[model samples]
Structure formats: structure tokens, C-alpha cells
Target: MAAGAPRIFVSHLSGVAVFDPAGDQVGRVRDLVVMLRMGQRPPRLLGLVVELATRRRIFLPMTRVTAIQSGQVITTGVLNVRRFEQRPTERLVFGELLDRRVTLTETGEEVTVLDLSVHQLPARREWEIDRVFVRKGRKGSAFRRAKGEALTVEWTAVTGFSLEEQGQGAESLLATFEQLRPADLANVLHHLSPKRRAEVAAALDDDRLADVLEELPEDDQIEILGKLKQERAADVLEAMDPDDAADLLGELPTDEQERLLSLMQPGDAADMRRLMSYEDRTAGGLMTTEPIVLRPDATVADALARVRNPDLSPALAAQVYVCRPPDETPTGKYLGTVHFQRLLREPPPTLVSSIVDSDLQPLDPDADLPAIAGFFATYDMVAAPVVDEAGSLLGAVTVDDVLDHMLPEDWRETEFHLDEEEVATDGS
Candidate 1:
């Protein structure tokens, strides 16, 4: 690293605010573009891919950059508003270089690259790769011993890496994604090429993949699902919320949907079938079949135990439904619900039925989106039980599902670009 040279890890530069010389906000750094060259030289920083307030991606050439600081980047006031399109020779540091595998020249050992450090070269206005941070040892293997702490090697000391190769880069990518929230992971997945996106999705566990799939746009969800094997796809669907699974299935061709559903477990398939039978905008379509349910005679302790499940969504865990025998949903008679707050206040031995909120009538499975929304708003509840005309507990509609239906059809495709101050203040 050069003395007095401002150095930043590639990961930190992502989402950093970009401003013009006048101190006016421009956009945020979405990615760093670089061009690979022959020989032992590190790739030179080409420019930046900036995402503006309009969600349009534009390029900022390195020549325009005046300063690179901790949370913000300064550029010459002049900027081309033209949307950025990748050229054949250009690659993204954040998108393509990070999380790749490279060989350490000293040890000839393969390590997954975690991040790259870049700095401006002396006597020149250009920035070049400075150091590479890499993690060694087999990924996801508990028995594998660490090869010591991550090594920060000079870029010149690494070799044998290329993003063009399939399966070589995914291990490191998924390792980093394991720490990201599903929404954030989905955003990164969305920006990747279809091939890379599928590769990353294939490496994720069923549960993690399900969560990311739910957060993605419908087209992306379908594309990833298509890439998965029928059996694996079924497993992923089974892991997702029944409502989300049904929605995704409904978007597929009827024959393809049937084929995938047939591969799912009978119980999960049945739940998906029931949810898929309703209109996309109806309560039944927006409900999850796995909400915590308890027998009328069950004690508060039992209800508390069920709500404590780590897999349960916060809204679903906020309350437990009290129902009559044949406890599996659809067959169970809807008695009432026990709010978690009530359970917390009551003695452990108290029967859940005794404290059930009978005044809060359950919504009919066929209830429209507006009606379902009103029910949640009126009761000030994050979730409400859905019942058939026979008063059988079918599922529970969560506020998130209801809101998804209420929002614009293309809401998932919408990009939310945080401003400079917001990114600086955000602790997460």
C-alpha cells in the first residue's frame, strides 16, 4: 500500500455515495469496472458503475473521480447520463472479481478470494488493485482445519483465476451470501448473469434458496426454479412458505406445476394445492398453512413451545390458533386464537382455550384482498386465521402476504436506492 494513498476494500466501496465537485449528490457506487490485461500486472480500475436516483445505471470513468473516501466518492461535476452497458473486455470488481478462487504463488495453494483492496498509484491518476484477501481450506467442512488466518497477499502473487470458468467461483460467493439477509442476497443475485445466478442458487441450501427465491422477482424465481432438478425444486418449494410456493407454482405452466408438485411430500403438496385453488388476490392465496396451531385442550406451555420455533415467521409466531381435533389444518375445527401476549401473562398450566380470543372471528378463505387487509387493520393483528365455511382451520394470512397482494404487481422489480446520508447512518 502506498503511503498517504486512500485505500478501500472493494466490499466497502459497494453502495458508497458518489458526489460531484460541487458537493451535489450524484449516485451510489454499484460496482467497480476493470479491464484485464496480459502478463503479471493486476487489472487496472476502468471506472465505476453508478446507480442514480432513477434506478438507472451509468458509468463514471476513472478520470472523473477526484477523491475516494470512506463513505463517499467525489467526481468531476460533468457526468454522462447515458445508461451503462458492459463492453467485451470490462468486468466488475464487486460483481465479478470478489468471491473468486485464485492460486497463491508462494504456496501454490488454492484459496477463495474474499475481497480486493485498491489504491491510486503514485505520479498517476489511475487506481490499481493493491492486495487480495483470501480464505483457505475446504468450505462448509467442520473437520477441515483452518490454514491460519486469511492471508492478505499482493495481487501480483496470485494467479490461475478466471470468472469464465463454471463452478469455480460459486463456493466463495455462497460463503459470503450465507451472511447476507435474504433480501440483500436476492438483490445481488438479481444483478448476476443468469448462468452465475443459477450457479449460486444451486450452491445454497434448500431453506436459504427458498427464502431468496421468495424475495426475487417472479421472472427470476421462475428462471432459478427451472434450472433446478425436479426433485430439488420440489424440496425447495416444500421449504418455502405455502403461499409463496403456490404463487410461484401458479406462474408455471400447468403441466410443469403438476410435475413439480407431484415430487413434493404429500403433506406439503396438499397444502400448496389448497392455496393454489384460490384467486391470486384472495385470502386463501395469501395464507400459509404452517402457522402454529394448538389443540383446544393444550396448555399455554405447548403454545409457547410452538411459537419458539426458529423457522416460524415473527408474524406467524405472534399468535397461536386454538382448534378442535384432527389437529392437521382443514380437518380441524376453528375454535379461536391465543395471542402470544396473553400466553406470556397467563400461568404456564392454563389452558389455551380458556384465553382464546373468540371475539376475533376468522376470515373466510375466499375473502378478497381488501377484506383481508381490513381484517388485519381492524383487529390490529399481524396475522389472522383463515377458515372454510364449515369453520375448519385452513391456514393463516400474514400481513406480509396481504401487503404483497396490495402492492403493485411489479413491486418486487422496483429498486430502492438509498441516499448517501442514509447509507452512512445505517448500522446494518
Candidate 2:
């Protein structure tokens, strides 16, 4: 590190607030932008990608950065209001560089890049890559000896691998995606080339791919799904929420849909078929068939265990349905629901049916969007059960699915702004 240089690990700078010279909060650092140069030269720092409160990403050039410490970034108050666009020659530290595997030039040993250290150049206002922190051995190997400390080597000492590498590089990138939230990973996937996106999707497990696909736009969802083998695509669909899986399958041709559906497990295929039977705007179409359903005789402890499942969404976990025999849909008979809140206040030994919300009427599968919306608004429930005419519990519609249907068709592509006018920078 340079003497007295304000060196910071790239990971540490993520989400740090950025402030203007007048001490006003501007935004938070989302990622660092760097320009790759020829040969072995360290990539030059280009700017900071800051995401404002409105979720608008703007660029703050290195010339505007004054200091880099105190858990926040200090800028000269000069910034371009235009959205940050990645140039062909530039790369993102967090999105592209971090968590990559590189070969040590000296020992030919491969290590995973954990973090990057950048420092301000002496006698210049520019920042450049200085060192990288790497962990020894490949990821998830039980036989590999633990390295007590991370090796910090100069950027020039390691051979940086390009993301275009179909083998190890792609694997390293996908491994890093595992650490991010599904929404965040979806955003990263959206920015990648179609080939790279397919590669990443192929590398992810069915559950993870399903979660990421759920967060993606419909077009992108179809594109990635098209790239997968029929069997693998069916597995991913099986892992997805029934409502979402049905929606995606609805976009395909009838023949294609049937082909994939036939490959899915019988139970999952049945749920998808049931969900697809209803109109897109109906309660049945928006509901998931996998809600926590228990017998009336079950204890509060049983309900709690089902709710505690990490795979269940918060809305689905918020309540449990009490039914007759056959806990699966179409459940034997619709009884009542036990809210998770009520379970917390009651003793574990207490019977769930004793505190069931009998007054809450289940929604009919044929109910329209407006009716479902009103039901949620009137009941103030996170989820409402959808029942058949024979009073069998079919599924539960979550509030999120309702809001998704209520939003504009292209709302996913729209960016909200805090104000119409751009603030003037003092250029201090």
C-alpha cells in the first residue's frame, strides 16, 4: 500500500453512503467502475456508481472524489445526473472482478479472489487497483487444508481470468451469485450477454434458478428457460412456486407446455395444471397450492414447525389452514385458518382448531382480480385461502401476487424518480 494512501477493500465500500462537499447525502456506493488497460497494467479506477434514494444510478467520476474514509465517500459535489452506462472497455469491481479465480504467476496455484484493495495514487487525484485478497484452494473442498489467513498479493502478481472463459471463470462467477439475493442476482443476470446468462443459469441449482427466474422479467424468464434442457427446465419449474410456474408455462405453445409438464413430478404437474385451469386474472391463477395445511386436530407446535420452513414465503408462513383428512389440495374439507400471530400467543399444546378464524370466508377460485383485491383490503390478511364450490381448500393467494397483477404491465421496466429537476452541484 502507498504511504498514507486511503486504501479500502472494495467489499467495504459497498453500500457506503456518498456525501457532497456541502455535507449533504447524495447516495450510496453500489459498485466501483474501472477501465481495463492493455497488458499487465492494473485497471484504472473510473468512478463510483451511486444509487440515489429514488433508485437511480448515477456516475461520480474519480475527479469528483475528494476522500475515501469514515464509512462514507466524499465527493467534490460535481456529478453527472445521467444514468451510469458501462462502456465496452470498463468493468465493475463487485459484479465482474470480485470472487473470481486467478492463477498465481509464481507457484501456478489457483486461488479465489475474495476482495480487492484500491489506493489513491501518490501526487495524483486518481485511484487504481493495488492488491487482491485471495483464499487458497477451490471452493467447498473438505480435503483441502484451511489457510489461516488470506494472501494479499499485488494485482500484477496474479493472472486475471476473463469472464468469457467457459470453464473455471464461469463457475467462479456463478458461485459468487449464490451469495446474492435472488432479486439482486436477477439484475446481474439481466445485464449479462445471453450466452453468459445461459451459462450462469445452467450452473445454478434448480431451487436457486427458480427463485432467480421468478424475479426476472417474463421475456428473460422464457429466454433462459429455453436454453435449459427439457428435463432440467422441468425440474426448475417443479421447484418454483406453483402460480409462477404456471404463469411461465402459460407463455409457451400448448405442445411445448405439455412436453415440459409431462417431465415434472406428478404432484407438481397436478398443481400446475390446476393453476392453469383458471383465467390469468382469477384467484386460482394467483394462488399457490403449496400453502401450509394441517388437520384441525393438529397442535400449535405442528403449525409452528410448518411455518418455520425457510423455503416458505413470509406471506404463506403467516397463516396455516386447518382441514379434514388429506392435507394436500383439494384438501378433504375446508375448515378454518390459524394466524401465526395467534399461534405465538397460545401454548404449544393448544389445539389449532380451537382458535381458528372461522368467520374468515375463503375466496372462490373463480373470483376476479378486483374481488380478490377487495377481499385482501377488507380482511387485511397477507394471504387468503381459495376454495372450490364444494368447500375444498384449493390454495392460498398471497398479497404480493395480487399487487403484481395490480401494477402496470411494464412496471418492471419503469424507474421512479424523487423529483423532476436535477440538483446543481457546487463544484467545491
Candidate 3:
């Protein structure tokens, strides 16, 4: 879009309407009211028409239009039909339309025009008003808000119609918060301003906050939780995996720790407490209680259904363990796991034993923390099923938890990045 482009004359006017600052319908354009020159030159448009009562037609100058989108055009000044009809003759042209200022009123807030550009469509070979750049006017002043300013905005701060017209300062940083995974949030948080951090934190509900906290530093976790009310903090902690909940709770002050535990659901609070009873770096503390377990007689269909559960974490599993009933003596009598992706090609009616991958490796519950992490690096697994001494199914250890053990305590204090090509190749 370029400045100083020719103003497009809209020939059709059966649907164009005059809209108020609040986007209320005021009047419709009835005709093109022209201003005549003294000589034999072409008659210029004084304004467009709005037919009112008493057979009056209102006119608005072509130069006053700020932008046009779709079927509607926005203009500078408010109009009254009788006033427009009685106005003295004035000549206007395309030159008067460029670089003019207009006050945009939306939701009682004023926005000032900065610049605009015109775009020509290739297929139609026709030009249309492209975009208007606007900056929000400051309170009680003509200036706009800048850095270090405390600007309070609600969810509906900007209207979609207004945003569509002006293509500047309309990016929603808050809207992108939910799109970030836990690791991405952790990486980006420090780069954000304090105000932006607060806005992002405030935007997340308890459940979302819990997911983000898993990737955040312990200090950052405490800081973010402190900003939240006791109820919100407790809810976030309760929603987290029991191991993660225990880790965060252990970092809080004694009074906050007590208060949060009391506020959490009793069952969830007890679970967190149980995990906290173990040393922070130990296997019992890091392992997840939730594991995909199936009875020996259970079909592959049953296991597939469980894996698709909404509560199931997003990390891919290497194998699905088929276990025996609780009454049986703990023996690895059940068939081994079937690769999750293999189910797609295999028939649904196939017995669990036929599909089970017998050569799968299992993790011991009492295995060293660092040793477990090494297994992941060696085998490239997202998680491995844990079994007790008697071959009884217990829990699972995820790659993220393994990384916690492998990386040094200070490793995450700095920025985190991985070689894109290396990651791509590793994933392949």
C-alpha cells in the first residue's frame, strides 16, 4: 500500500451507512451529492448522501474519509442532513485525503491516526484502502502511552472491526500465552517485561499455570505463586502431577506451605505430602503414580482407549504394559507391551499376546536417578514403565523428570536452547 494513491470513487451506494463512534447505525447513503465548479470543469463530490425526514439529504466530503473496508467507509466529521444541505460550496480532491488526522473513538477510548497505505489487488487490478495505523491516546492528554506506563486493558480492549481497519499495535501477546508449551513458556518468560509477565500470568487459569510451573525455575515458581491468591495457588499445586506439586510446595515458606496444603483438595494434598516425604532428588520423589496398566486378559482395544484418555500426558510411550489381576502372585506372567504406533496397522481383534513386543526393557523402582536418565539418552525413550522387585507394575518415569536428574542444579538458570538441526536429526 502506498501513500498519495488516487482516491477510489465508490459507485454503488445502496448499502453504505453512516456509523457512529460506538458503531451504532445512524444513516444510510442515498445518493452522490456533487459540488459544481464555476467553469465547464467536471463537478466534484461535495459529499455522499444520507436521506433524513422532511425530504432532506445530508452530504459528507470525500476528503474526510479515513478508510474503507468491504462495503463501508469511515469518515472524519459527524453529519446532520439539514446542516449538510444548507452548507456553502467547497471544492475537495484526492490531494486533501492523504496524511489527514482522524480521532478514532472506540469503547470511549480515543485513538489517533499515524499513517495509512493503499493496496492494489492483482486479479481484479483494482485498488482498495488497505490499512490505517493508530495509537491509543493517553488519558486527559493528546499523547499516547509509552514504555514504563501502567496501562490497564480488559479482554475486549480492541474491537475486531477497528483492528481490521488499522493493522498496528493490535498484536495480542496475552492471547498467545495458552499456545506456549511448558518449556517454551520457561524460555520466553525472562525476556518479557514485568508488566507483560504479570499480564501473561494473570491470563492463565489455575490448570494452565500448573502446566507452566513444571518448566519454570523453582525461584520463578515461588515468585509467580506468591502473586496469586491462596486459593489460585493451591488449585495450581493440586492440579500439577504429585511429584511436581511436592517439589514446588517444598520451596514455599512454612506459613504459605501450610495454608496451601489446607486449601488443596484433601486427597490431592495427601498425595503431595506422600511424595514430599521422600528426598527431593530420589527415585520415589521423581516418579509419577499414573501409569497405563491393563489386565492380562484385556484386549489391545482396551489399552488403546486408556492411552487416549484426556488426562493422559502428551509424552509418547514406548510400550503398553499388560499386567495380571491383583489377586495373582506378582509374576511377569502377562504378555509384554505393544508399540503404541503399531496398533494403527494391526487389526483391532488381534489378541494382546500376539501384538506384545517381548523384547521391551523395564525400569526398576529403586534404580539410581542419574542411571534412569542415562537409559533414556541410550534408548531414546520419552518414558519407561517402572516395576517392583517382584515384577509388579508400579509407576512411570518421564523424560522431563529424567532431565531434572541429569542436568546440573544451575543448568536452567541461564537461557535454554538446542541446535535445531541436531534436534531434527535426533527426532528423526
Candidate 4:
């Protein structure tokens, strides 16, 4: 569903039927899984607990739900199919929240939660419980068939529901800073106590933790990874960019590295191994194994679609590489680069090979950092392909990765400021 979707009351969603893409019935929504935040912030709606025909319940993440309209839920048809097990950080709307009694912050009067209204945040995929439908009456059954004066109020208007205690762990802190960008969040983590830092790290989801870990200093990355369960640590590593993952893995003991590698997917582990084989300051080590690679016959439309993926960094999306065959990395003979600007200037049906720029030379895998930096500067390129001696395209290195390595080790810690007189002179 798009952002700004209409508010959906939990009571109205009771036993709502859920269907797959082709109109096949999958299950019915039994409960909504949410994680409560500190004090006044609304709780984040995680997903739905759906009950299958076979009496099995599975958790369907909100990301998978394509739409919730006309009293039915539509899914993208992809599911884990595993049984639903609520984590310590999760709460069920139907099972736990419906019948709860809370106090109205405005009047110190008791209220019973009748239902909750969830709405999607504008421009974001997140859904949150923004309003509480409560009744000002003595606590009775979860749904008391409309007893006293009922009204909808902001989520913050109620006080008994949020985390009553804040100092015990990072739950409150995490909730407070949930909306921060990765770089800002990294700064926050850097200033936290070691124990609290680990707590926050452990609380974050795998994907989020991966992004934040990439921004943190090497020492913090090592410390956080060291404290996690080995299996979880492996999963986090797999979620990280291949180049960054390899860099972090290179800092561990040989035995430790081998152990984690064994737990990762064979394909992912192989990529990490290949990257680690190169010198830390070489093109091969600095390049990410994942890139937009297509055969010569692929159309501009296909390349555009690949570049539109939200997960790709801007530098990686700035260009596409056309190869002979075997589209994945270690792709067939490297062909030519197609800038996104060129794609926009051509028709959608035009073949990428016809417009490819073969005049630009690719970087050798063994190119040193200084050589690679000079290549980018000389060409005014944001990204460049790394080809092996055999003419196979291994990966592409982005400008961001080059800057990360080129900057001084202590640059992240250094603070820069100017006096008022200097600022006035330079005009900021």
C-alpha cells in the first residue's frame, strides 16, 4: 500500500481474509504484531499474524502486504511459512492489547482499549498505531459492546500502555532514535556506553544493524560483532555489503573467520573469500560484488528497472555494465559501460550494447587505491568496473567506498568548526 493509506482499526480487521497475488486464499489475519515504544511515541506495526487453513499461524511482515482494502488483505505471495513465534520485543494487538486498561493522560481517568487505528507514514513504508479508540468506563471484557463514552485520541493521550520503565535496557532508547539516519545513528552509538551500545546493536533488526554497522568505526564494528551469537553474527555479516563484510571479516582471527564463513550461504561466503584474497587497498578489495550487470541484448528498460532498486547505493545505480553472458559477478567477458544519462536519452526498447561506451577503460583488479582514485578523478566517474586478467567482470567500485578508504582513520572523530568572524568572512 502507498504511504498515507487510510487508518485501519484493529477491530475492523478482525478475521480479515488475506489473499495471494493471483487471488488464491492464504489465511486470515488473527492478530497484529507491534513493538511498543517509549512514553509518547506511537508503536510501530510490525506485521500480521495470519491463521492458515490448516490451523497454523504465520507472521506476515508489513513489507509483504501489498494492500489492505475492501476488507481483505493482498500479499506479494512470498512467505516464510514457518510458525509464528513472538520475540521478546514484539506484542500482539489482538492477544494482548485489546483488553488492556490504560489511563488518559489529560484527565487521570481510566479507559479501556476498544481498538487501535493504524496508518501508513507519508513517503515511508512504515505503519504505526497513531490513534487509540478507548472507552471511559470500568474495565470489563476486551470489547464490552459499547458501554461508556467512546472517543478516538492520539496514541500519546494514553499513559499506561507505553514502556513504564526506561533505564533497564535499550528498548526505550532505540524507540526514541528509531527514525535517525544511519550516519546520525552511528554517531549516537559512538557516544553510548559500551554496554548500552551492545544492547542497542542487539535490539536492531539484521538489515538495519548491517547499515548502521557499515557507518561505525572499525573498533565498534568488531566489538558489536564479537558480542552477538555466532549464527546471528553470520547472518548480519551476510546482510552487509560484500566489500564491507570482507573488511570486517579480515579483522578477525583466522579460526573465527573460518567459523563464520562456514555458517553463511555458500555463494555469499565465496564472494567474501574472493574479496579477502585481494590487498585491502586494491580495486578487488574495494569493489562490491553485487552490481547491475546485463547481457548485451538487454533493453534500456531492463537496465532502468535494475537501477531503480531502492537498496542500491546512488553510485552503483549511476551506471550499468553490459557483459557477454552469465549476468552475475564473474560475468562473461566485460563489454562496456552505459551511463544512466545515456539510458534516459534513448528509447526504452533500445539495446544497451548499441549505446554502450567502450572507449572508457575498466580498472584492473590489482589497481592500488591511489591508482583507482586517479582513474576516477581523470574520468570524472562515480563508479568504475573492475575486470580481471581473463576479461571477466568481477564487480564495480563506487566513489563512496574509495572515499571511505582514502580519508584519514581519525577523520570520523574529528570535529570541525569556525569562529563567528571566520564564518562571516567565508559566508559558511
Question: Best candidate per lDDT, number?
Answer: 4
Where in model 3 is the C-alpha error above 4 Å?
1-172, 176-178, 193-196, 309-311, 314-316, 324-336, 341-345, 351-361, 377-380, 389-392, 413-428
Model 4, 270-323: lDDT tens digits are: 999999999999999999999899899999999998887666899999999999
Q: Give one digit per residue, the lDDT tens place, for model 3 in 40-70.
A: 2233344556654455665554434544555
How much lDDT does candidate 3 score? 0.56
Range of the 10 consecutive residues with the lowest summed lDDT in candidate 4? 419-428
Residue 89's lDDT within candidate 2 is: 45
Q: Cα lDDT for residue 395, model 4?
A: 99
Structure candidate 1, residue pairs in collision: none
* Candidate 1, residue 170: lDDT: 61
Q: What TM-score fits each model?
A: 0.60, 0.60, 0.51, 0.78
Question: At residue 24, what lDDT does model 3 achieve?
Answer: 63
Off by over 4 Å in 1: 1-168, 413-428
Q: Which stretches in model 2 have alpha-carbon errors above 4 Å?
A: 1-168, 416-428
Lowest lDDT sum, 10 consecutive residues, model 3, at: 162-171
Count clashing residue pairs in model 4.
Answer: 0
